[model samples]
Target: MTLRLSVISASVLLALTTHSIAFADDSAFEVIEVTGHHEGSYSSVSTDSSTPQVDISGLLEQLPGAAVNGNGPLTGIAQYRGLYGDRVNTQVNGVTLASAGPNAMDTPLSYASLVNSERLEMTRGIAPVSAGTDTIGGSVKVIESQASFDEISGKVAAQYQDNGQRSHLGAKTNIANQDHALLVYGDLLKGSENTTSGSGNEIAPTTYDKNIFGGQYRFNLGDSGNESIAIGYQHLETTEAGTPALPMDIDFIRSDRVKLEGIHALSSWELNWHLAYSDAKHGMDNFSQRMKMPSMNARYNNADSASFDGAISVGKDTWLFGIDSQLSQHNSVISDPTMAMFNVDNFNDVQDDTYSAFAQWQQDINQWNWQLGARVKHYMTDAGEVSHSMAEMMPAIKMLMTQFNNADRTQSQTGVDLVLNGRYQVNSELSWIFGLARKQASASYQQRYLWVPMQSTGGLADGRTYVGQMDLELETAYQLELGADFSSDKLTISPRVFLHRIDDYIQGVPATDPAVKMAAMMMGDDNPMQFANVDAELFGMDLAAAYQLNDSWSLDMNASYVSGERRDIEDNLYRISPPKVILGVNYKSNNWLARVEGLGVSAQDKVSKTQFEQRTAGYGLMNISVAYDADSWMLKAGVNNLFDTEYEDHLAGYNRVMGGDLSPGERMPGTGMNAWLSGEYRF
Candidate 1:
């Protein structure tokens, strides 16, 4: 019974007192229709591209039940519909952190750096307990665009890509008036070593490097901004990155983050607050960035982490109240730079904390427009008391670290979340929506403290090897959704259908402990795995559309379909993602713009023999882009796989780096035929 919370989220204080824009050519896909009392329908996607995304999961795969579980090419694990890693919840720029690589390869969308990210929002279905303290596999927001309440602006960009000869540059600056404002940004990206798979080979020399910089300070107490405060700072540095599907590689990762937000305007209630902090340090190795191992199998790992989250809110005239929090701590070790007596503690003194409280209500009732939210969350995890030196000559790893150090590694949990949403605006171009939810999660301190056998499952790169699960439970979800929207004046569409049903669903099994299969066959792996509690069920449908066949032509589309199963072992559910579609066509006026895209996917034979999975076949691709928007200069170009098709991306990951050209658990191919160029400037 311990809870520590800091809450805020009144839509991030109405998006920090509003007025934010910094999207230079966000490539349209616009579809908005609201009436008689509203607010809800999303998509802010546009990770500003000219193709040169070494990360940000390729712009979260163009949203719509999104997907990306690549694990190298600079990692990326974020799945919306079929839940992914720590059950997805990330907010960068608004801060919420933890991912110092426990095999996540620095996931959490790799701290939103796709060359100075600007927007990558989410919230289309079943998310809302005021958006997070864990949305139970939902909640993503990475926004950065502030400055200009009246004055100096900034932007500078650069890009180049020719399949792994990649590069990107970034800059941002803004200093304002009207009671203070400032924003500073920096970026850099590097590459080489992905020679465009799909038989153009070279899938494992694995190279990548990254950088990001940040700054923010905002203040206003009257004179609009409705009373506000903001302070922020962020920095990230990654070096020698390469995750050939895990087993080490990534010589470094560093992070530092901070945030504080505010809003106040009393006169009948209005207050908001937000706080965030993070520190991450990570290092990995398996022969100094890939290949060459002897000297007792050379390996190294170092980890350090910290996270503090916040929220505080109050609103009136539509009711809202909040309290939310997060706290994280981790430390990992494991070394052997040629044996300093080969140490390993891997994860010691770890902790995962959470706290929350929420209440929300919105109303309109004329054409209906309602929302209801409620939440109560708690989780406190613990660890510490572990040791190893190859477990004193391995007595089955010293009896599983003496039975996980005499057991009782705490885990306390409490959860209750609910949401009821509605829209029904049968006029002004149609609308109908519904959502009901109940979500929760607990278990992820790398799934209850790994005491031995490792692949550090958090990234589940699926090379397999796992351990940890000390009375783990609590992973609920029960949801429903239905949707609609149809506008006119040149068409518009939005659709949805959903289901969730989770219940305990933790997954990963096949370690019928016999001292964890004799210490995973003396640490060489004999197929050990564990992390149970299952039940599962997932259903989906998604769609988004646009038409407007005139006024410089337009057309857009997106599609998704999900299906996960394991309602008590009928199998199927483990890296699920298949069924996809995207289509585009555009033409803009004045200052030319052009686009043409097509993508299709489908052919994943419902695999997952308990993660012995492998099934992919089905692909299509095409792309083309053109832009020129000059006034202060802008130029863009693109040509991704225009006809160099060669598929195999069942969500990648499984090429355990050993040699070039992949093998040793194959399947990690997709990407070839590229062309990109970009330039931007604005002042």
Candidate 2:
């Protein structure tokens, strides 16, 4: 299968290359100047007619050094360089959305619906401190449609795909006068349990249905100010969604959110304020999506969060400052209807609060642009009384719980961040960029408060159980980056190299205590681990290039490579992405456009034995798309994974679902050939 796909891809590439026009000296894309003095590897996504209604992680994959690790259709976790999850900060309209599920079934990007957004941007390498607090990975920002007063506008779109029998419909409208405006949007998506692997075998428990709706109201303040209030709600229902890396299957996830924002302009400064609140409820079970075990167990978890932010900014070469705060609470419970006395409280009254203050200074000196920023943050967590039915059955466990309950259950920590960025233009067509930063992040609530072994370690899905360390110290990172951008009439290229060293990096390792291992064995548990701190280092390089072959054709390419290892021991880090490359050709005419691309990933042999990581083989995929535009309507059609070659992703989690050809510990298979069509009408 792999050989067949590679031959097909090579033939397509040869055909496209032979038909290309003569090379010409011209820019491949229009260059847009940034409004601020920020310096970094930044890219903006086009939200025009050609963009599809997919998750944020899917869109981010178009950029260099980015990948999406999927647990479900909507649960796409963004990975950049060699880090992911909480290490990266995602913001929608300058507000952060907290995950609702303990296993991260509802990721931060899950809240930002692509149907209602207008623009998206990503910052690569070391991000500025002003972007957000605790940003060791990078940042993703999304801007939603805003109320317009110039005229009334609306759009309706629909799409269908054959892989999972998936369907989507969305509509949005804006109504406004000279003094006030209102915008409303809604979307519906549904799919069946028919997702097929590259081998044409159906993957069970992969169906879902979801609905989203939101509205925003804006009122004109004076000449250059406005106040807006917005509300959003999302409901997701899953019949048998599988989490191959974790222990359970998701049954349902429901979330609701509200936000209020106001901007006021003064003589030489602008004041901005925002407030947000969100609530999420999730349920999971072992029998719903896979083979039923003797213990027909079910679990439910609920989480809620509230946040506030305020900032004041002056003109360029001035100062900007702000303060932000967030508070969250979590609770969980388990039940078994067949057994009368089978009940457990996994988590109870777990609360966390975070507050931070930041300031930034940007200035332009001669031919150089520079920015300096700092942030201070305080974090605290407390867990009320916790109990479980298993503890009661085991006297040794009961004694450990008694001691834990009597000890102090509250912890606090404070950390600081500093960042500096500079850019220098050597000539009109070349620029040099450099950045340095020191960042810190406190442990999560699950890492600091979990009393029993569980599978809630940031959704690693590694099929390992871990216990929390209450006295864990904060993790700190030192990072540096250097890059250059070269642009000419017919070519544009940007390349960057970065290095990161972390102190007291937190990770899960094998639990070696005799008594703990004996107790776990007695409870029918294996692969017991505990969270510990170790030093680590990572280095990587990313390159992106584009060339214009003529007025009707263009070529683009991107490549990324990264490596990570434990500094204190001779072992490799876990779940790091292997080297990858993407190449594409695009042809455009008066009213239509067509594109073809090939993507390839190299084999990953650097496995981490302590984490029980496995190696994966290499694979390549072929894709093609075409689109056409009329007076007020547009249509797009595409096919992905054209060869249906069977392969597994190095970053994918293990297969845990029963009643399948694949074993429990085997890597999950990638999706097979899929064809889709979409259309939109605007007024």
Candidate 3:
């Protein structure tokens, strides 16, 4: 039955492409121009009348050197270049978002709902300190849709995809009469059976449901000033969602979020204030979503966070300053309901706080534009007290716990970051870009306070248990970037390359201490590791180009390559993305559009022996899409992985879920060929 469906979808895609080619004409089609400060750094603005109401990670994948690491439909993590997780700073409507999971099951970007957003932007290279604190990798921002008008206007949309059996519906409306305006929006999304892999096998336990609603009001004070206040709320629930990379399966996850924002404009100065809060409760077990073990193990975690930020700006050659603060608390417990005696407190009353102040200056002189920024941040963490159920039965484990509790449980650090960027327009069709930055990032809570050996090291999913380092030093990075942009009437191209030198890079190294090694072996574990500092270097390049083929057709291509190695050790960095290229052709008419694309990924042979990283073979995929417009309505259809070729991504994590055909250490398979149809009506 699946084969028949795949064949039918392939035939339909081919027929649509043939029809589109025959209908091509000399009529000129509009092309969106890409804007950027350098070759590796660019910005994209959405022009669609209504947002897709999908996960933000999927949208980010359209950019060069960007990919998504999938654990489940709602647990996608964004990867850029060779870095991910907290290394990348993500924000929504200029406000920072915090992750609510110890293993990062809910990434920062996962909270951003597309229904209320206008555009998404990313800075690929070393981001300026003003972008955010601790942005050693890059920065991503989601701009919310604002309400403005002398009249009333609104839009509503709905969509469905068969691959995940997902459905989304949303609506937004604004009412204004010169002096005052109000905007309101809402979204509903649900999905099931999201585990059908490319090999016709179910991955088990991938389903989710979510709802979000918000509103904003604006008041005009004068020609040069205005004030606005906004409020938003979101709730999400998931059932039997599997994280094959992690040790446990998610039986349920409940999350709630609330946000409040205020903005005031006065002459040449603007003032912005934001406040947000989130609470998440998650549960996992060894039996519900996977095979039952001899001794049932169940875990529960609760996390809550609050953030506040305020900024002020003035002048076209803007000078801006801001202060941001965040506080997070987490607690985790493990138990076997079947056997009440097996219960422990894995993490108890863990608290983390971050406070930062930043300043930025932007000015243009002649043909040169320059930006300089600086930031100072402070971090503090406290793990009140912790204990385990087995500590009483094991002398070595009990001794370790006593030492951990007696040590300094409270730790703090301070760091600074600086950035300088310049762009010189040599002529009308060409520009030169250069950037230099010195950035610093403190270790994550899990890296510094995991009192015991566990698989919670930023979700590496390498099947190795790791212990935290309480005295680990902060990581400092120095980066240099150079690139250029060129454009003509019928062609446009941008290319950039960058080099990064890192000091005190934190990574897991094999444990050498006799006591620690003995304890790990006694606990039925092998190859135990501990976090330590090391030196590393990374360099990469990104290229993007587009060419118009006559008036009705266009060709677009992009390629990315990156390499990373430990300078102080004889091994490569773990889980670096392989070289990749994407090529696409498009045909457009007054009311119809068609596109076909091919993506290629090179084999990854630069594996990290120390981390036991696996090498993956290269793979390619074909995809086709078509869209049509009729007055107030629009239709879009697409077929991805058209050939149903089974392949595994190099960055994919291991399959830890039990009762699967694949082993625990094998890589997860990619999705199979799937077709989807969607329609939207503007009213």
Candidate 4:
């Protein structure tokens, strides 16, 4: 039977290579480096791989103004130093997860799944306000994995690559009777993919699936050690594995979540509380194809979403305070492809709502240290469309169209956000940091669904309706950050610099003139949408260092650089930051571990052609990994793109009728040498 299951998977990876962690006498299980900051003197990097699809988003497209649009097995809506869409913001454990194509090339926890994370936080720019509200290009968090005492844990994993193969299994349990505590966990996964492009051509072969479940409970009211209460529940489902000539097709996605928390202590302050709720459902199937039309275009859609959050906290002198709230709702439907022809029908509907409230503070006033915040938000939208074409046909198609209607439009917004931060202590090694922030932007649902496609050849254009301009304001931003961090006794340096500004920066222009481009399409209100208040800028600089040369060795490095543009036609506005430099090297003992990494990018040449249909050209990459550990089971193995080079990223998208390049573009496509093995067991 396949050689007794390959000798029981090599004796269970030689008994987890001999035990997961021991660290030569350091307990509390070392290895915890989590730090991320935005604003208040932003400059962050506290390693354990700066997450982006489980690790550095494929070496950050080899720096130098990075770019990656699409290619294969993609997940990781990347953008760093140059930002993208909705000003980048992602959260988990602090809520916020909603996105299923409204186009930013998809990202909202990227189809969820990161091997049961227990820490992953990233903040780029103009952040801080206690990490909530429209972040101006930054914020990513995921923290999951809980259970302690009477521990009962489990994991099973599998992998294969050349474009597909993955399997996973999980289990967790923790219970303590005597003070009341309970915890439970579950996981299941599946994956498949096939891709090859960027001058190798093979495109399309995808399959991904996942399911997860969770539970947690806690209680304690004695021991004068204060008090505690916690409750949680989670459920998730995912699906989508069909691609090639895409026009949309995804028919499964579900989520359900609940949470509650509390803590207490008196005699001089200490209190905390939180609440959460979530519900999601998404489905899709839509296609389009033309160019010698023989008819073939389908449609079907669905979306249902919900969200809520609440929080409170307190403390003083040296400070710590909080108050926050959030709410979200979505409902959508689309079904109109000539209603499967013959006795036609059509449909479209939409609704969206959002709300927010905030207050926060964090402080220290000796060598200087601070944080402050504020926020307010409210938004709403409603949409509708209908058509019942050709009832019982003929009779000149029911007298040239007997049914058509549209009515039901609404949009609303209310916004506010502010923050300030500071730090100092320019001695004993070094320290200095600064921050300032502001975010304002509201009303979005694809700019209120605006479509205009009719460049001749069997038309369907002349649909111009967008009621939102209701003095549509908000969409303002301001940012400033300065940095300094130094250490000695085995190195640890840091450097940071940033500047950002945006005002009425909601862009989209082109209302073609000359009789609306000879009446080719988009009429009403002279279509050619508008939302302006332009003048944007971004500045960047980042440098990091790490060193430790004893007891097992260590070394690390970092680099970053950015320019400007959000508008003012900065000559096709380049800078979507990604390159400047980044490098690394590592080696360890006590069960062996090794690593080598490099990435570099430059040569953009002031791009054009819509920035080369989403920039590219500038690459360098190399990666290597080695793993081992032993005792009570735990083992790992690795080999990834040791040199298969070919790159692009920035959630690539653009294919002006297939000549703009970037759709099905090249990204994370350097996997010619790949390998992985994992094993674990504990009792």
TM-score result, candidate 1: 0.34
Clashing pairs in 2: 26-489, 26-490
Q: If ranked by lDDT, best first, what sequence of candidates would result? A: 1, 2, 3, 4
lDDT of 2 by residue, 390-477 (tens): 6767765565566557868888899999988887888878888788999998887777766666777767878877777777888899
Task: Report lDDT (Cα) of residue 220, candidate 2.
Answer: 76
Which candidate number would show the highest TM-score if scored against the true structure?
2
Ten-residue stretch with the least lDDT total in model 1: 1-10
Q: Tell me the whole-model lDDT of each prediction, alpha carbons only.
A: 0.76, 0.71, 0.70, 0.50
- Per-prediction tally of clashes: 5, 2, 0, 25
| Model 4 lDDT tens row, 218-283 | 777656425777787888776773332234434566778788887787557777777888777766
Best model number under lDDT: 1
True-vs-predicted CA distance for residue 209, candidate 4, Å: 20
- Better candidate by lDDT, 2 or 4: 2
User: Which digits, one per residue and each the tens of the lDDT, describe model 1 over residues 509-549?
Assistant: 89887887888876677888888888888987776666666
lDDT of 2 at 516: 52
